[model samples]
Structures are given as C-alpha cells and as structure tokens.
Target: MKFTDGFWLSRPGLTPRYAVEVDDIRVDERAGTMTVYASTTRIEHRGDTLNRALLTVTYSAPAEGVIRVRVQHHSGAVPVVPAFALAADPGFGPGIHVDDEQGILDAGGLSVRVHRTGGWQVDFERDGAPVTHSLARSVAHISGGEGTWMHEQLALGPGERIYGLGERFGALIKNGQTVDSWNADGGTSSEQSYKSIPFYLSSRGYGVLVDSPDHVSFEVGSEVNTRVQFSVPGETLDYHVIAGPTPKDVLRRYTGLTGRPARVPAWSFGLWLTTSFTASYDEGSVTEFIDGMAARDLPLSVFHFDCFWMREYQWTDFEWDPRTFPDPEGQLARLHDRGLRVSAWINPYIAQRSRLFDEARERGYLLRRTDGGVWQWDLWQAGMGIVDFTNPEAAEWYVAHLERLMAQGVDTFKTDFGERIPHEGVVWHDGSDPARMHNYYPFLYNEAVFRALERRYGVGEAVVFARSATVGSQQFPVHWGGDSDSTYLSMAESLRGGLSLALSGFGYWSHDIGGFEGTPDAGLFKRWLAFGLLSSHSRLHGSSSLRVPWAFDEEAVDITRQFTRLKMRLMPYLLGAAEQAHAEGIPMMRPMVLEFPDDRSGFDADAQYMLGDALLVAPVLSADGAVEYYLPEGEWTSLLDGSVQEGRRWVVESHDYDSIPARVRPGTVLPWGAVDDRPEYDWADGVTLRCFQLPDGYDAETTVPGADGTATAFRVRREGARIIASSSDARAAWSLQAGSATATADGAGTLTITIEDNR
Candidate 1:
C-alpha cells in the first residue's frame, strides 16, 4: 500500500495525480455541505487548465465537532452498503467564512481551512491552533497495473501515539505498524486479526474512522515517519474525523455514530464449560463432566457443544449428529432442569454432501461465480459453499435451521468462521460490490443470527459467542479471541487482544480458559482459571484435548471452584458495570489510559486493566506466578484479603494459584450477593454493601440486577462518623466493612450506621 520511495520520490510503476489548485467552490445550504473542484495541474491562467483531470472533494458536518470528508476520482461509483452508521443532524448548521485566498468551515469546535492559492494544503485546527493538516502532494489518486486507489495522508504531531486498530496482539501502541483492515483466521502470535476495525484514536485528542468496507491499508508512521497514510482500492475515499477534549468523549461520540453495545443476559456472567473442539464426545461424556463439576461444588452456568455436535463435512445443515448426539432434545432438557444454558457451534458454509445443498443451489441461496455457478471451496470442509447473507431468502433459510435448534432447547450459538469469505469473480444476490463485502460479510452473517435469537427470546435475553466482527457488530453481545495455544505466552497474548478490542468499543469479551490448541499443564490451567473467571464471559474449551479441571490436577479443580464462586459473589458489581457500558459506549473492562489519561505510564500499561472502573485485575502471566502492576494515587484495598497497597508506584509480587491481583479503588461502595452457588438469582434480595475505605463526604451508587431481569439501585455516602444508605426498595441488606457500624433506619427505608474505623 506504500507508494512513495522516500520523502521526495515516488515508486517506479505507480502514477499519482495531486489536486493542485481549486478551480471552483460550491455551497449547498440545504444539504449543509461544501464542494470544491480542483484540477490536477496548477492554473496560473485560465488557459493552464486546458487538458487535465479534476478531483472533487466534499465536506459535511456529521455531528458536533465531527467532520466527514469524501474524496473522489470518479463521481459515478456508489457503494451498495456503507460500513458505519450515519450521524443525525442537529437543527443548526456550521458557520462558513470565505475569502479570496482561503475558505473556513466551522462546525462546533472544529475548523478546517481550505487554501485557494497553495498547491494542495488543508489545515485542521481547534480554537486557532493547528492539530493536523495535509500538506503539498499529500492527497493523491493513485493508479497501478491492477486497479486504482484513493490515498490521503495527515501529519502526526510530536509525542502523539496511536491505539485501537482492532483486536491486535502485537503491540498496544500502533505507531510504526502497517495494518490492513481485512479479517483473517490468524492466531494470537501474528499480525493478522480476526476483527479488523478501520478506526484509530490518537493521543492528540482526535479520532479517524474510515467509512469503507473495502480493504483499507494504514501505514502508521511506517512509510512516512511524520505522517499516517491510508489508502483504499477504489474510486472514492470517505472518512470522518471526530474531535474530543478527552479520549472517553471521542469513544462515546464514535460509538454513537456506529452503534452502542447491547446488554447480555445475567446468567452469561458465570462460568461456562464447553466440549472441546475436535475431541470426540457423546451424551454420556457430557453428562459425566456436568455431574463432576456439580459434585465438586463448581458453579456452572452455560455448557457449549463444539463443531463435532453436527455431522462431519455438513456444517450448515444444523442437524445434530445421529450417531453421537442422537438424543439432543432430551439431553438439553436435562441440562435445563439443572439450571444450565446450552450453546452450539455454527458457521456460514454448507458442504456439498449436506442435505440442504441441492435445495439452496436451486433457490440461489449460495454465492455464484461470474459464469452463474455456485462458488465452492475445500479449505475448511470438502466442497463447502458459503451462504450469501446479502440475499434476504438466504438469510431466512439459514435462520430457519437455527430455529429448529432453539426448538430443541439450545439457548445460544457460537457464530464462528466468517473471516474467510470470497471476493474473486463472485457475485452477490443484491448486486453489492463483492470487494466490499469481503470484510463486511461477518456483520451481515452475525446480524441475521442475532436477530433470529432476539425474535425467539425477548430483547435482553439474546446473546451469542461470536468469533468474527466488523464495524457495527458491537450490537451483538459477546465476542471471544480466536485460536490461542496452551502456554503462558498465549495467555498474555489473549489478554492483549481483549484489551485492544475493549479499546475499540467492544463491551463484553472472552477467551478460552486453558487456551485452544493443546492441553495445558496444571500450572497454566490453574492460572488461566483465575483469569477466565474474572472476565466478562468465561468458557473452557480446547482443540484436541479435554479442558475439564480434574484432567489437570486436584488443585486445578479447587482453583476453578474457588474463582467461579467468587465471580458469582461479584455479579452485582459486574452487572451494574455492564449497564454503564451499554449506556455510555465505554467497556466494562478498560485500559489504564482510559481511567487515568494524565499519567504517561498508563498509556503504555497493558499487563493490567480496570474492571468496571472500581477493581484492578492483573492476571498472573508467569509460570512462577510473578506479577508486577501499577496503581494511581489513592488508597487501595484488596478484594481477596483485607491487605492494602499504596498507590502512585509499581509493586512486584508473587501469588499462588488460589489468588490474583484484584484491588478495589478508594471510596468505592461495592455490592455483593449472598448466593454463591448460581449466577441467576434475586440479587437485590440479600445484597451486601461492602464499603471500602472511604474519605469524608464520599458518595457512590450502584445497580443490583435480579434473576427476572429487573434492576434496583442504591446510593451510599460517608459523613464523619457514620455512613448513610438510602434506597426506595427495602430488599437490600447491608454488610458494612469500612466501619464497625450499628444500623438504624427511618420509616422511609434509609439506614445510618456508626463506623468503627478500626484501621
């Protein structure tokens, strides 16, 4: 994607056309836009523009402090489906100031100046200070042997760092990296990513998101040290620049433009066990594992059936394997009787021998080649044809099979493998451009299944364990990191991927507890058990080996039981955090920079993360259980024990398999539940308000989620010698820890307790 040889030379074969002089400018008051026509050759006189091509640049204000720019070489190419959602317009438009030498368009707090006499310079500013700009020869329409491309480059300020180009595992900071926005099946050790989002946030208080589903290549300080260049292989390049006084504001506005994350069900917050992929399993084996967990006092919530649940080579048929899973309905009923949900794995490809293949071929539900034959490949399965989600009947036909599984009592699905879509000489049913649908295929595929689930279950009860996603796919509830190996290194890499995805606006994320490729030893399994239970969603899965706790060691089973019960106890605090994420577009698990933006070290800290803006979780990554973490200036208390650690410095410590680094922030009123055996219960019935060490005049509030999907809220504040708790609902009970307190309540459901303050 890089075209320039150096600072002053172009590549040998590529021809570039630069917009030199503005020939004309038109303003559309009705559309709230400005259009400029610029010629490739400079026009010193009227005769100088005799024979040349002209480029068109259009600008509009999408929202307050946000500008959308579209550059076009040909004006006739209209994309079928744009990736991100469009912004809603306010009543008033921006202010425009034009002069002979320049023109300025002011939208809220952001301003862009278009030079009329310079070669090709556009400067962006905030309050009359330069933020970033495109200099001479920075905007070019490029052409090579294969096709044409539209390219744009913007200057990067000193000390500015880039973050969030999707679920990347290489480095948290994206400077000096060449990234392509294309989904792939690459594992955690490579540069390829399963979820490739065309958005990035800079530390310089701005964010840029390209509104294209075609392959976008970003050279972030790689080709040019002082510039970030992005190019797409097409006639038009459309993107938006979002301004922010803070990073959280930029994320909120960006997610508002795309879509906010949805709230998943409460039972999904507990520990989930899965039948290992590629391992042979029958009803007996599954029942034995479920019974073993119950016998050992491990709290289980969801049980997942992997790919082998269906017959081999017939992925999309949606029929359970008769030989292995002959009694799926009865088995699912038995599981539901035990208060556990069920999940099954599915993909978008149908094999040649599947029973529905001939019917789909006749009904035109499969993608066709240029010669009007069904496109087939043998990559993952023998002669597999991809279902065309762009077609309405095709999506309906695919969802009908899922409906059959729901009838059999399957609660959810693991929507996997939408990253390997085809684009070479293929045709879509809706006549959409195939090049663009390659990266956007997962959005359509996942949306079809998600809508089907929502139709069957009610609004807040639908959820999916999806693997691949694109721009607006956050509307679906949960996604997991794909294909990690069994090692300490892979565990850390998975955490890096989850942190990166959370920064990219995903609310809930999970990964395989003991990795996905091989069997983990007892040490790795116990360490991963603690980390997995602390995640937004927890699952135990592997590729060719069993992931049961007892398969490793006795201590592994104890660790699993211990952390699973701990997570069940922490559901009130976690569920309230999920509601905050759904409402504000922030994530439940946040990077250190998102919490403390002023600290420079926070920008680079990826080894630890903040869970729900209150507790800091640092997973043990070393085989010897060594961990080092940093905390901001505050009074910190351990949630595991009553031990306290001072803030504003780094501390190195070692832990056993029974514990992790979970610390609550100062002045936090954390909520806990009395029920420790199940994730689904009436949380407000016996809620315990575990108040951490609080300063005077400190106030905090949280919501308690119930088993029937209703929420009750409470507020607490500390005043000198007593803490006051107020709630309209009287279902909550208190367990005061910050003080030795005796409770006294008024008739209006308000209770005041005297603090012992033994510390």
Candidate 2:
C-alpha cells in the first residue's frame, strides 16, 4: 500500500495522479451534497483534458457533526459489497456558505470547506476552528504494477495521538505504526487483530473512519511525519470525518452511526467457567468442576461447554457428543437446577462429515466458489464449509439449530472463528464482493445468532462471546480477547487490546482468565483470576489445559472465590454502568484518557483503566505484582481497604494474589450489594451506599438495578459539614458508609451525619 519511495519521489512502477485543482462543482440542494470534478491537471483549455481520468468526489453528511467524503476514479465499476452495515440518520442540513474562492458546507458543528481555486484542498473545521485538512497531493489515485489504489492523508498535529484501530495490542499511541484493516486469528502478540475497525480517534478531538470493508492499510505518521495515510485496493475510496470536542462525544457519534451494544443481563456480570478446549471433558468432568467450585465457595453464574461438545469433524452439527454427554438434556437441566446458565461453543462452519453440512450444501446454505462448488477448508476442522450469512435462508438454517439448543436450556453461545473467511475467487449468496465480506463476515454471523437469541429469550437476556469483529460488531455484547499465551506479557497485551476495544465503542469485553494457549503457573493463574473477575464479563478458559481454579492451586481457588464475590458485591455499581453504556455509547471499561483527556499521564496510562466513571482498576501484570499507575487530581480511596491516597502523581504499589489496585474516585457514591454468592438478586435490599470524598459542592448518585428489572436511586451530597443520603424507596434497608463510619438509613429514607473534619 506504500507507494512512495521517499518524501519527494514515487516508488518504481507507480504512477500517482494527484487531484490538483477542482475543475467543476455541482451543488445539489435537495440531497445536501456538493459534487466536485477534480482533474489530474489544471483544466486550462479544451485540449488540456484529452485522454485523462477525472476523479469525482462527493461530499455529504449522514448525521450532525459527521461528514462523508466519497472519492471515485471510475464511476462505472459497480460494487457488489454491501455498505458497511451502518444505521441511517437523516441529518438536518445545517447551512451552505458559498463564495468565489471556496464553499463551506456546515453540518452541525463541523464544517467542510472545499477550495474552488488554487490547490485542491479540503479543510475541516470544528466550530470554525481549523482541526485537520486534506492537502492537494494528499488525495490521489494511483496506478501501478500493484493495480489501482485510492489514498487519502489527513494532517496530523503536534502531540496528536491516535487510538482505536480495533482491539489493537501493540501500543496505546498509534503514532509510528502500520495497521491493516484485516481480521485475523493471530493472538495477542501480533499486529494482526481479531477486531480490525477502520476507525481511529485522535487526541485533537476528531475521528476518521475509512468506510471500506475491503482491505485498507494505514500508515500512522510512519510514511510521513505529519499525516495519517490510508489506502484501499480499488478505484473508489470513502471515509467519514466525525468531530467531537471530547473523546466520549466522538464515540457517541460513532456508535450512533454504527449501533450501540445491547444491554447484557445482570447474571452475565458474574463469573463464567468454561470447559477447556481440546481437554477430555465429559458430563462427569463438568459436574466435578461445578462441585469443586461450590465446595470452595466460588461463585459461578454461567457454565460454558467448549468445542468438544459436538463430535469431532462435525462442528456445526449442534448435537452433543452422546459418547461423552449421554442425555444432554438431562445434563443441562441438572446444571440449570443448580442455578447456573449454560453456554455452548459454536462457529460459522459446517464440516462435511456432519448431517447439517449435507443439508446445507443441498439447500445452498454454504459459501460457493465461482465454479459452483462449495468452498471447503481444512484448517480448524476437516472439510469445513462456512455458512453463507449473506443469504437469509442460510442464516435462518443456521440459527434454527441454535434455537433448538437454546430450547434445551442453553443460555448463550461462544461464536468463534469468523476470521478465517475466504476472499479469493469466492461467491456470496447475495453477490457481495468476497474481499469486502471477509472482514464483515463476523458482523452478519453474530447478528443472526444474537437476533435469534433475543427473539427467544427477550431483550437484555441475549449475549455472545464473539471473537472476530469489524466496524459495527460492537452491537454484540461480550467479545473476548482471542487466543493468548499463559504468560505475564500476554496478560498485558490482553489488557491493551481490551482498552483499545473499549475506546472503539465496545461496551463490554472479556479475556481468558489464565490465558488460552497454554496452562498458566499457579501464581499467574491467581493473578489473572483477580483481573478477569473485575472485567465487565469474566470467563475461565484455556486451549490445552484446564482453567478450573483448583487446577492451578488451592490459593488459586481461594483467590477466585474472593474476587468473584467482590465482583458480585460490586454488581450494583457495575450494572448501572452497563445501563449507561446502553443509553449513551460509552464503554463500561474505559481507558484513563477517556475520563481525564487533558491529563498527560492518563493519555499514555495503558496499564490501568477506569472500571466506570468512579473506580480505577490497575491490573498488576508483572510476576512480582509491582504496578505503577497514575491518578488524576483527586483524593482517591482504596476499595480494598479504607486507606486514602492523594492523586496527581504515579503510585507504585505491590499487591498480593488476593488483591489489585482498585481505588474509588472522589465524588462517587458506589452501591454495594449484600449477597456475594449469587449475581441475580434484589440489588436494592441490603445495599450499602459507599460515599467517597464528595467534595462540598458536588453530589453523587447511583442507580442499582435489581433482578426484577427495577432499579433504586441512591443519592449523596456533602453540604458543609453534614452529609445527606437519600434513597428512592423508604422501606429499602440500605446502609450508608462515609469514610470509617457506617449507619443504616432512617425510616424516612434519608440519613444525615456530620464528619469530624469535612473536606
């Protein structure tokens, strides 16, 4: 994708045709668009335009504060790929200001100015202040031995940092990186990502998303020091410029364009134990693991059966391997009887040995080659045929089996392995371009399964542990970091990936507790247990080893019990954060920069993140458990202990296996539940409202969601020396904790107390 040999020279065998000047402009008042025809050379006379291809660029707005620019070199090449599955928004075209030199089209607060003379440059301004610009030569159509490519480069400002190229793990700041927007199954160590979103937000309060599902390459300040360049392998290039003064605002608009994540169930916030992949596990093994967890007082809410649930070479058969699980219905019923929701592993693949494969091949439910034969691969399984999600009947045929499994007590599915979709010489049922459908395959696959679950179980009750994703796949809740090694480095990389994904508008993310590739040591397992339990979703899974807490050590079991109970007790606060994510598209697990954008320390603090708006969680990733995390200006208090630490500097601390650096931010009223073992309960009953240093003029409030789909609001404020606490229900017996003092709420649903030395 790199066409330049140096700053001033093009590469060999490359002919770059730059859009020098705008030749003509046609304004469409009805469509609210401005179309420009830019020729490679200045159109001086009638003979100057002979034998030349002019680029046609259209400027339009899909929503307020969003500007979409579509550039095409050849207009007759019809694209079979579907548009990157985005939600439509009919924007109120703000106004159009035209002059002799330039035309400024204002949409919401963002303005795109098209230069009518001199160099062909498009300048983007947010609220009349210059943010970024596409210089004359920055927009080009290149033709070479590598074929045709359309490229665009946006000016990068000083100290501008880029983030969110989909769950990336390399670095927090994407300044000197080369990222490709392609989905791959590479683990946490590589540049390849499971979720390669074609969007990125900058520190300068603007974001750009290349609206191409095909392979796109980005050189972030690498090829050129002052611009972020992206190229696609086609004659047409399209991108959207989103303006936000704040990082959260950018994500809000981005998710509005795509879709917001669905609200996950309350029970999904609890611990999940999975059958390790490739491990010899039968119903007895699963039962023993459950029994062991119960005996150790470890709280588990969901149990997942991995790929072996189906027989070998029959992945999408959807039938339990009767040799191991005789009476699968009875087995699931017994697990449900023990108050546990069940999940089974499924992928969008059907091996040829299975009966479903024969039916699908006959019904045209599988992806086919150009010669009319079904596409088959032997990577994950023998003769695996991918289900063509482009066809409606194919999706229905696939989901019908999932519905049957759910009817037999399955709660959710771990939709894995959409990254291995074929792109070369393939045909989609709906005639979508194979190259574009490669990365978008997961979106359709997960959507079909998610919608099926919602139809069966109702809203807020469906969840998928998906792995691969593209731009809009964040609508599916609970995507986990893919295959990782059982090492400290992998844990840190997993954190980086999750933090990046959170910024990319995914509300909930999880990772394998003790890694997924190999068995972790006892110390590593115990440490990862704490980190996993604190995530928005927690799961214990591995590739070749058992992920049961007792599989590591007795201390591991104790640590699992401790952190699992802590997360359960913190559900009142976590569920509220989830509700916020559903309403406004901010993530439950947030990067520190999202909360404190102006703080330089928070911008590079990838080791730690804010659990919500109120609590800071720094997972200790070192073998020695030594962590150095920064906190913004505040008076933070440890949720583990009542000890306080003044912020605005880095805090170096060492934690044991039982604890992490979890501190409550100032001006927070965190709600804690009484029941520590079970995740689903009346969250308002026996709830304790822990009021952290609520600076005198500020008020803190939280809503605790209960099992019956109702929530109670608890409010606390500090006025001078007296702290006032109020609840929505007068009969709710809740405790109020301010510093070291704890008092039960009075009968009037309000409690007033005076601190000795109120800040």
Give the TM-scores of the predictions, in the order they appear: 0.96, 0.98
Off-target runs (Cα >4 Å) in candidate 1 are 21-24, 39-41, 90-92, 117-119, 127-130, 706-710, 739-748, 753-759
For residues 1-759, could you state the per-residue lDDT of candidate 1 as single tens digits?
799898787788888988877877778878888787878887778787777778998888878788888999998866566355655566658777777888777878777888887678888787777778877777889987788999889888988888887899878888899999999999988899999999888777778888898899999999899888899987889988887756777788788888888888888898889999988789999999999999988889999999999888887789889898889999999999999999999999999989989999999999999999999999998888989998899999999999999999999999999998888989999887787888889889999998899999977789999889888888887999999999999998899888888878788999999999988999999999989998889999999999999999999999998999999888888888888778878888888877777777667778888988899999999999899999888878888986889888887889999989999988788888878888877777767777777788978766777666676777888899778777776655544445434453322276767776622
The models' CA-based lDDT, in order, is 0.85, 0.89
Model 1, residue 45: what's the lDDT? 86
10 residues in a row with least lDDT, candidate 1: 739-748
Candidate 2 local lDDT, 453-523, one digit each (tens): 99999988899999999988988888999999999999999999999998888999999999999889999
Superposed on all Cα atoms, the candidates' RMSDs to the truth, in angstroms, are 2.1, 1.4
**Against the true structure, candidate 1 has what lDDT?**
0.85
Best by lDDT: 2
